[model samples]
Structure formats: structure tokens, C-alpha cells
Target: MSEFRKCARTAEAAMRSVFPATPLQLNAHLSARFDADIWLKREDLTPVRSYKLRGAFNAMRKLRVSAPDQTIFVCASAGNHAQGVAYMCKHFDVQGVIFMPVTTPQQKIFKTQVFGGDNVEIRLVGDYFDDTLAAAQTYCSEAGAAFLSPFDDEDVIEGQASVAVEISNQLGSAPDHIILPVGGGGLSAGVRSFFGHSTHYTLVEPEGGMSLAAALETGAPVSLAHVDGFVDGAAVARIGDKTFARLSDMNLSDVLAASEDRICATMLEMLNVEGIVLEPAGALAVDALVDVADQIRGKTVVCVTSGGNFDFERLPEVKERAQRYSGVKKYFILRMPQRPGALRDFLETLGPEDDIARFEYLKKSARNFGSVLIGIETSSPQNFEALFRRIEQAGMTYTDITNDETLGQFVL
Candidate 1:
């Protein structure tokens, strides 16, 4: 075996003492839909509900062996990483200081606290993650604690490689392709290194956080100017330097960007159809299947479902985004005459499958006409075409603001 694979095997062997191997099961739903042998490496089912625990446990185990006196560990994260570190700290009986942004949801903070118990100190630091990270590093330097990076450390990378080790053993052979979700590139780098061209690979990222693609183009990691934080799990602004070094040579075409709205649709499908709850980042690999359907057809493919840390509170937003993306829901501003029958005229134009979701008057005081905001939900996308025709035939003027980001933000 190659040196990297050997180290990965060692890590995998060590992981059994901490937690059982995550399941690798053939997904009949995905197999039938894609016309391929679709296997899911269920990293989402880990103790901390993410592949992150693997790296955290491995890194801390090796660290304690090498430097017995270094009992204090520090890390900064808003979600899965924090929970992973907390769980490992408790398991190892080590003291850890975890820094998280103040804006982190109470649900996440509560879970982290429950995982770490008394072994981890939770610090609610700055408003932003970057600021929280800075605070953690500063505290580490002042207190002489060892700072643990979420993805930049060599030991952590080695730990993540354990995922690949498990996959190979579980599958009994290399698959035709492996699809991985890239955040800071740790998981992708580790898995890619272990396989080393033995199989084809597809790297996926949230469209708003395509750090790997940007790094490949610039020849170095560069911070994105703006990032949509909807996919908070994989919405990294920049790829980690160490992780990027291993993945830098990958073909740019292999990197796929999934849209935030479209990802919501995938999340809903997995929940409604497959009965799986996936966080935004956790769903990346599966969501990417749409883009690679042709390439993976009739081949054995594995998709690593990285995490399942979804908050039930976000379900409404997820549903809304899914409906919007599928064109089953839309918002529009209509110009209506300032008369009693004018409102009834518009109401009479609705098709049988159309339902009004939202209605508000924007210009109630107009002398001749009033502007009304209307949200319509229909059974199918074609329903909108028919609805629009009815509105036009009635001589009512309207602007479809469902896709107008600016207007949607302000009104919808």
C-alpha cells in the first residue's frame, strides 16, 4: 500500500475505539433514479452527526501520544466542527476551549455543550466567524494552549483520510467514481490522496462558496468577495492552505457548483422521498448527482453524506426555497384599479390549481390605481404561464418579482 493509504488505514483502525464505522449502504432510491449503483457512505450517522468527529478524534489521540503534557486544545467553529471537538475532548478527558460566533443558534450551542459536558469551555466570541477564530487563536497564544484547525492541520487531514479507508473496505473495491463535498478541502484532499487516481472524483461546493474553484484559477487560495451563508456548512470563504496543496492539481471541470435554491429542492426531496434529514453541506454530494448523471450512469458510485446537523427551525425556509426553485410558488406586483370590482376582476382570473399565498396593498391611496403585492402558489410551473395569460387578457399590468433578488429581498 502507498504511504498515505497506510496512514489512513492506521487512522481507520484507531477510530473503532472511539466510534463504530459509519454505514455504507446501497441506496435503492438513488440507484433507480440515476440508473447506477449508488452507495452512500453514511458519515452523517456518526456520533457527532458528521465526518468531523473522525478528524477530531484522530488528531487529539495522536497529539496526546506525542506531547503528553499538551492537555489543552482550542478550536473555533459555529457548527459540526465545534460539536466534534467537544465530543472528542470529552472522550479523551482533555480540556478544550471552543470559540463560536455569538450569532450561533442556541440549538447548536446547546448540542455542543451537551456533547462536551464539563470537558469543554464554550466561548461565545465575536459576531462573525473570522472574528471568533481570531479570538480563539489569540487566547491559545496567550494561554500556551495548542490550537487545532478545523482543516489545515496534517494530523486532521490524516484523520479525514480514514473516511476513504472505510469506504474502500466497505465497498471491497474501488468505485467507478467518488463524489465529495468541499468546504475547506480537508475531506476532499484526504480522500483524493488515499485513492490517488484509482477512481474518478467529483468535487462539489455551494455556488456562493466555490473556494476550490477560485483557488484553482488563482493558483492560490483567495477569499471570496461575497458569500451566501445559506449553505453555512460548506460556505467557506477560502480553501485552507494545506488542504488546497493536495487538491490544487485537480481538473477544474471536476469541480461543480450547486445553487443554494436548487440545494433546497434536493434537501426536501431527500426528506420527503428518502426520509433522510440532511444539513445543507451534508446534501452537497447528493445534490451534485444531477450534474453528473450522464457520467455516472451504469457505474458504481459512492456519495459521502458528510453531515446531518440540520435544525428543524429552518424547515420553513427550506420549503420556501424549494418551492421557489421548482417554480411552484411566485410573487408578483400587480397594478389594480382603485375600484370595488377591480379586486374581484383579478380574483376571478385565477386558475383552479392556483392559490393566493400572500396579498398586500402597496399603494392604497392611489387616485386611479393601486399597487398590490401578490404571492401565488400553483401545482405546476406551467400554471404560471396560464395565470399570466389570464392577467394579460384582463388588461392588468404586473411585474414578476419572484426572481428579482433586489425586489424579493425588500418585498417578497
Candidate 2:
């Protein structure tokens, strides 16, 4: 075995002391759909419901071994990494201080507390992640505590390599393809380092936060001016410098970007079809399979479902996005004439399968015509085509705002 793989094996052995290896299960639903051998590295089933705890535990364990007196660790995270660190702190019987954005959901905060128990102190620090990270680093420096980076640290990278180690051992050999979700790129970097060119890799990122693509284009990591935080677990503004070094030579073609709404559709499909709940980031790798279906046909492929920290409260929004992406739901602005029976005429245009989800007048007192906001849910996408044809044939004026981002944000 190569030196990197050897180290990864060591890391995997170390992880057994903390938690058992996450299962690598053959997924019949996905395999049959794509006509390929599909396996899922179920990192979502980890004790903290993510693969992050491996990295945290390894980093802290290494620190303790190298410096027996080092007992304080600090970290900043709003999601999976925070819980991972908290869980490790409790297991190692060390003091850890975790800083999170004040805007973090109460559910996440409570989970972190429950995991850390009395071993870690939770600090609600800043409104944004960057601010929270800065505060954590400053506190760590002042208090002489070690600050554990979520993805930028070498120890953390080595820890994450354990995932690859487990995969290789479980499968008996490397698969034909591996799909990985990229954020700060720690997990991808570690996995790629361990496997090298033994298997094909497809790295996926959220369309709104393509930091890895930006880094490759710039020949270096660069901060994005804006990032859509919808995929909060993987919506990093910039790839870590350490991670970029490992992925610098990766082909840009192998990197895919998944749209937020499309990812939502994938998440909902896993839940409704397979009884699997995945966070947006967790579903990214699976969602990217659509872009490379031809390349993976009849090949053995593995997708790492990174995390399952989905908030059940967001199920409604997830369903809404899935419906919009699937074309079963839409919102439109209609110009309705202020004459008698105008409303009746509009209602008559709807097909039997069409249902009015929302109908409200933007302006009710116009002398000639009133602006109305309407939402429609239909049984089939073809139903919308027929409905639109009827509206056009009747000389009714309407604007489809379902895909109009600015207008949808304001009214829909």
C-alpha cells in the first residue's frame, strides 16, 4: 500500500475507538434506476449523523498524544462540524468551546449541547459564520487553547481519510466511480489523496456556491462575492488553501454544480421513495449523478451521503421547491379585467386536474383591470401547457413568475 493509504488505515483503526465504521450499503432503488451498481457510504448514520466526528476525534486525539497537557480545544461551526467537535469533546473528557452564529437554529444549538453535555461550552457569538470563526480564533489565541478548523487543518484531513479506508476495506476493492460533495474540500481532499487515481471521482458543489470551480478557474482559492446559503452544510464561500492544494490538478469537467431546487427534489425523492432523509448537502452527490448518468451506466459507483442533519421544519419549503422544479406547481401574475364575470371566465379556463393553491388581487380597485397573484398546482406538467393555451386563446394576459427570482422573492 502507498504511504497515504497506510496512514488512512491507521486513522480508520483509530476511529473504531470512538465509533464503528459507517455502513456501505448497496442501494437497490438508485442502482435499478441508473442501471448501475450503486452503493451509499452511509455517513449520515454516524453517531453525530455525519462523517465530521471522525475528523474531530482524530485531530483531538493527535493533539493529546503530542501534548499530554493540552486539554482545551476551540472551534466555530453552525452545523455538522460543531456537533462533531462537541461529541468528541465529551468522549475525550476535554474542555471544548464551540462558537456558532446567533442565527443558528435552536434545534441545532440544543443538539450540540446534548452531545457535549458538560464537556463543552456553547457560545452564540456572531450573526454570520465568518464573524463567528474570527471570534473563536481570537478567543482561542487569548486563552491559549487549540483552535480546530473544520476543514483547513492537516490533522482533520488525515482524520477524514478514514472514510476512504473504510470504503476500500468494505468493498474489497475500489469502485469504478465515487461521487463526493465539496464544501471546504476536506473530505474530498482526504478521500482523493487516499485513493489517488484508482477510481473515477465526481466532485459536486451547490450551484450557488461553486467555490471549488472558482478556485480551479483562478488557479488558486478565491473568496466568492456572494454565496447562496440554502445548502448551509456545503455552502462555503472559498475552498481552503490546504484542500485546494490536494485538488488543484483535478479536471474541471469532473466537478459538477447542482442547483438548489434540483437538490431539494433529490432530497424529497429519497425521503418519499426510499425513506431516507438527507440534508441538502447530503443529497448533492446523488443529485449530480443525473449530470453523468451516461458515464456511470453499468459501472460500480458510490455516493457519500455526507450528513442527515435536516430540520423537519423545512419540509414544507423542500416540498415546494421540488414541486416547482418538477413543473407541477407555479406562480403567476395575472391581469384581470374589472368587468362582471371576469373572475368566472378565468376559473372556467382551468382544467379538471388543475387546482388553485392561491389567488389574491395585488390591486383590487383598478378602474379597467386589477393585478392578481395566482398559484396553481396541477397533476401533470402537460396540464400547465393546456391551461396556458386556454388562457392565451381567451386573450387573457399573465406573466409566469415561477422562475422569476426577483419577482418570486417579493410576491411568491
Candidate 3:
């Protein structure tokens, strides 16, 4: 075996001491739908419900041997990495301090605590993740603690390569195509390095957090000026410097940027149809398949359903986004007459399946017309065009605010 393969195997062996290998199972629903044999490297089923544990375990194992007296480890993360480090701390009976942004959800904080038990200390600081990361690094330097990076370190990348090692062994061959969701590029770098020259690869990144794309364009890692944090798991502002070095030569054509709302549709479809619970980033690879259908058809494809640390509270938001992306829902600013029966006349245009999700009169804009914010959802996307057509014929002026960012942010 190559040096990297040996390193990955060693990491895999260490992981077995903590938890069993995650399953590699064929997904018939996806296979039949895409006309491809789809296998999911179900890293979501791991003890930490993410592949992050593999990196954490491997990094700690290597560090423990070299610096046994270094019992304190430190890390910064808003979600999965924090939990992974905390879990590893508890498993190894070591102390760790995890710094997280204040914006991190309570559910994530609770999970990190549960995983760490008494071995980890949670520090809430900073509003943005970058600020928290800086704080953690400073704390590590001052406290003499070994900082455990989530993905940027060489050991962490090598450890994450274990996923590819397992897939190669289980599948008996490199897959035709392996779809990877790019965050800091650690997992993608690990998987690509393991496959060597065998497998065709595609990288999927969230549109708002296309760090990989930015890195590829700039020929080096660059922080994004703006990022949409909707897909919290993989929405990184910058690709890891070390990991991106390995991925810099990859073809730009092989990378895809999935819209946040479109990703939501994939998440809900998998949940309601396949009974699979996937965090937003987890669904990126699967959703990207839609864009690359021609390339993967009739071939054996593996998409890493990377994590499932989805908090249930976000389900409503997910559903709303999915509905809008699928064209079955919309919000509108209707200019209604101030006279009575105007609301009734507008309501008459509704199809049987159309439901008023939001209805509120903002204020009277003029003596003759009042501005009303209306949100309508229907069983089919086609209903909106018909509804709008009727509105036009009836001389009812309206503007669809569904795709209007500034307006939607303020009102919806």
C-alpha cells in the first residue's frame, strides 16, 4: 500500500477501537431514479453522526503517542467538529476546551456537552465563526493546549481518508464517480487522495458558500466576502489552505454550486420519501446528481451522505424553502382596493388546493388601494401562473416577492 493508504488504514484501525465502520449500502430509490447504481457511504450513521469523528480520533491517537503529556486538546467549531472533539475527549479521558460562536444553536451546544460529559469545557464567544476560531487559537497558544483543527491539519486530512479506504474495501473497486460535498475541502481532499487515479470525482458546494469555487478561481484559498449560513454544516467562508493545495488542480467543470433553497427540496424529498434525515450539507452530493445526470447515468456512483446532525426545529424552515424552490409556493405584495369585498374577490381566484399561508395588510398606500403582504402555497407550481393571470384580468395589481431578496428578507 502507498504511504497515504497505510496512514488511512492505521487510522481506520484506531477508529474500530472506538466504533465500528459506517455502512456502505446501495440506495435503490436513488439508483432507479437516476438510472445509476447509487451507493451511500453512510458516514451519517457513525457514532458522531458525521465523518468528523474519524479525523478527531486519528489526530488524537497520533498526538497522544508523540506528546503523551499533552493531555489538553482545543478546537473551535459551531457544530459537528465541536461534538467530534468533545466525544473524542470523553473517549480518551482527556480535557478539551471547545470554543463556539454565540450564534450556534442550543441543540448543538447540548450535544457537544453530552458527548464530552465532564472532559470538555464549552466557551461561548464571538458572533461569527472566524472570530471564534481566532479566539480558540489564541487560547490554545496561551494555555499550552494542542489545537485540534477540524480539517486543515495534515493528520486530520489523512484521518478523514479512512472513509475512502473503507469504501474501496467494501465496494471491491473504486466507484465510477464519487460525489463529495465541499466545506473546508478536507473530506474531498482525503477521498480524492485515496482513490488516486481511479475514480471520477465531482465536488458540490452551496451557492452562498462556494469556497472551493472561489479557491479554484483565485488559484489559492480566499475568504468569501459574504456567505449564506443556511447550509451550516458545509457553508464555510474559506477552504482550508492545506486541503485546498491538494484540490487546486481539479477541473472547474467538476465543481457544482447548489442553491440553498434547491438543497432544501432535496432534504425534504429524502426525508419524506426515503425516510432519510440529512443535514443541508449532507444533501449536497445527492442534489448535485441532478445537475450531472448525464455523466453518472448507467454507472455505479457513490455520494457521501456526509452528516445527519439535523436539528428538528429547522424542519419547518426546510419545508418552506423546499416548497418555494419547487414552485408550489410564493409570497406576493398585492395592491388591493380600500373598499370592502376586494379580499373576497381575490380569494375567489384560488384553486381548491391553494392555501393562504400568510395574510396581512401592511398599510394603506393610497386613498384607493391598500398594500397587503400575502403568502400562498398550492399543491402544484402551475397554479401560481393561473392565479396571476386571473389577477391581471381582474385588474388586481400584485408583485411576486418570493424571489425578491431584499423584500423577502424584510417581509417574509
Better of 1 and 3 by lDDT: 1
Please list the C-alpha lDDT of all candidates, in the order they appear.
0.93, 0.93, 0.92
TM-scores of all candidate predictions against the true structure = 0.99, 0.98, 0.98
Q: Candidate 3 lDDT, tens digit per residue, 363-397?
A: 55458998888999898998888999988877799
Q: Which segments of model 2 are wrong by more than 4 Å?
A: none
lDDT of 1 by residue, 62-121 (tens): 889898999999999999999999999999999999999999999999999999999999
* lDDT of model 1 at position 332: 93
Task: Give candidate 2's whole-model lDDT.
Answer: 0.93
Q: Candidate 3: what lDDT?
A: 0.92
Clashing pairs in 1: none
RMSD of each: 0.9, 1.0, 1.2
Error of 1 at 184 (Å): 0.2
What's the alpha carbon RMSD for model 1?
0.9
